[model samples]
Target: MGGTGTTGTTRRISRSTTAALAVTGLVTPLTLALGAAPAQAAPACTAGTGPYQKKVEKFLGRPVDGRQSTADCRAIKAFQTKHGITPNAGYAGSVTWGVMDLMTKQKAVGTNPNRDGRCPVNKGRVACVNLTLQLSWIQDGRTLVYGPVPVRTGRNGDETRTGAKKIYWRNIDHYSTLYNVPMPYAQFFDGGQAFHQASVSMWNPPGSRGCVNMTKTAAKKYWSLLRNGDDVHIWGRKPGT
Candidate 1:
């Protein structure tokens, strides 16, 4: 999306074609033998609530405490101004949800500074930012949403944590006894916690030792849209929403 002139492109293609030649920069069609989704244009970006879009919109659409809107960017801006926040360059941000969560709930989440998640969006439409609540929002991966989740992390000191973090995915398996957490599942932006599918307690905050855990539902959603290097931001608490 380009500034105020945000626009996205979509292309459609046909199926059952082999040896197709490239034309007009559209993705080349796969040989029918692969059994991939047919050569079709990328879906249009709408405010619609498909399973994928719904997850994105749910986080983005909730009202700030007493105020919410699906089409009211004005309301969002007003809420931001009231909170004295920079009001974000756009609705896509890393820490927006945490702040918004506080705003609406009028409550703080996470116990330590290491807990808490961020707001992240792809460079343009390349990725999606998804965070689930376990104890703290655990740092997941830079993979497209289908990446592994629910993987275990540091217990006590090993708990997966986010914010001000600086660890890399490559180093994760080095410390784990199981070594099952994939390197790619590590969201390197935050050092401590790496993303994986694991069972962590997350009913009303402060469930994990420090790592982020996802429910079965959230793990599946995270696996669908997240990609490497999508923007992520975490806010300590919400403004007086």
Candidate 2:
């Protein structure tokens, strides 16, 4: 049910705005004008303190002073850019902080993501999806077979339904006509929501339509490890969705 959008190529147009002084044969005027022009300054980082400033600082390992600083802005901006957040002006707004908070919780999950015993251990080969942390892993009995890798789930209104399901179908080279995008290594678990490889960044905000979007490597691994009829257990709510 979910698919990624293709990125369009950006075409840059360079324009020459220098007017030649024909009276003097020398090109010194043009050279001087070009040299005299000041280099464009970089966009200023956000100066005012954001609502989640302290939280973001703590997450980034910066001093939790509850105020914005130049270093803090740069660090936060780098993180936001890495996660595909827009503007990335280094403002510790709710969206940026939300992503950080989710990461913090996911990190706390550690190596044993299924310690709660929520997913059925005796189900043989099972794929466990933790929507809260936006992670998925394959387990054989009590032994881990695959990941606790990061994933991108459904957005606000189009939330991925949580329940016990089984992999009913699989297509290595799948294409979604509805979304007009490729869904590689597609494995259908629920009615329409499936596990597939997406071109979009997994850390991007909002999230997919209804599918569990994974990296190409993770999807390839899942394609090799899982098959039709494998148990799929999904639980918890995707934060901010």
- State TM-scores per candidate: 0.29, 0.79
lDDT of 2 by residue, 1-241 (tens): 3842222122233433253322221111112112121222334678879999999998778999998999999887777666668777789998988877776666667667799988789989999998988888888999877767778999999898899999887766667766777777788887667899987667688898889998767777787788989999999999886
**lDDT, candidate 1, 1-241, per-residue tens:** 0000001121222323243333221111111002222222332222322222222245445433322234534333333333333432224233434444432331223122122224333233222222332122223343222322212223333333334333233221122323323221223335343443343222212223333444434433433334455444433321211
For each candidate in turn, give its C-alpha RMSD to the true structure in angstroms.
Answer: 18.9, 16.0
> Which residue runs does candidate 2 get wrong by more than 4 Å?
1-44
Candidate 1 residue 145 Cα shift, in angstroms, is 11
lDDT of the candidates, in the order given: 0.30, 0.76
Q: Indicate which candidate wins on lDDT.
A: 2
Error of 2 at 170 (Å): 1.2
Rate residue 19 of model 2 by lDDT.
Answer: 38
